[model samples]
Target: MKTASFPSLRVEPKLRQDTESVLYDNESLSQFIESAVRQQVELRKANTEFLARGLASRDNARQTGQYVEAVDVLEKLQNRLDQHKAKHTTK
Candidate 1:
């Protein structure tokens, strides 16, 4: 497959040096920047989906007049976490 290139980026010398300093052994600067961009894209996509789901849930609750209390939700989540930890704990 043909490959495309990102536009050249201009940054301060210190920032360039800092980024280079963090590069893994034998890893290229281009690879590092590409990985960072990919990670940010995924994070933004996840955040957008999370917000959409929450909004949909809110609208559905308003329409149905069926809502869960914050405390009750938290308590149930805590119980689940406790159970998971107990189950996974080494005896």
Candidate 2:
């Protein structure tokens, strides 16, 4: 893989020491920071995909006229639970 250099950043001494403590003795700070950045980017990408899927589901529900108010949905669930309890309860 091709390599690139980053401009120096000024960080607090304690923070730098903390980061170095977690890295292997032979690992450069740049490598550790790069790996962390890649992981964060991947996490953000996954979050974006999840949000897109949720929005698509909402859109589909709207298009089908299947969307209900939160209160209505909660009430329906409560009704089902009450019916279930009534059926199982004796006397």
Candidate 3:
């Protein structure tokens, strides 16, 4: 596999100790930190993509006049909940 180097990070003493303790049993600290950084970067990329898609969907809904106001949505949900509670309470 290809290899890359990361600059040294000055972490808190306790954080460094915790990382080292977890890494001591299996892999080197460098490998653990590299894997962690890579995972974080990928996670952020996925989150950005998800937010972009959601915004696009909202824009489409708005353009089609399909988007309901927050108050309207809340009222619908509240009505449903009230109906559900009424039914269950009487049973």
Please name the candidate that would achieve the greatest TM-score relative to the true structure.
Answer: 1
**Stretches of candidate 1 exceeding 4 Å from the true structure:** 87-91
| Cα lDDT tens digits for candidate 3, 1-91 | 9976777789899998998888856699888988998899999999999999999989999899887789998999999999999989954
Worst 10 residues of 2 by lDDT: 3-12
Question: Which candidate would rank higher by TM-score, 1 or 3?
Answer: 1
**How many clashing pairs does model 1 include?**
0
TM-score of each: 0.88, 0.63, 0.65
Error of 2 at 76 (Å): 18
lDDT of 1 at 9: 99
Residue 9 accuracy (lDDT) in model 3: 89
What lDDT tens digits, residue by residue, belong to model 2 across residues 33-89?
999989999999999999999899899998998877999989999999999999999
Q: What C-alpha lDDT, on a 0 to 100 scale, does residue 54 get in candidate 1?
A: 99
lDDT to native, each model:
0.99, 0.94, 0.90
lDDT of 1 by residue, 30-52 (tens): 99999999999999999999999
lDDT of 1 at 18: 100
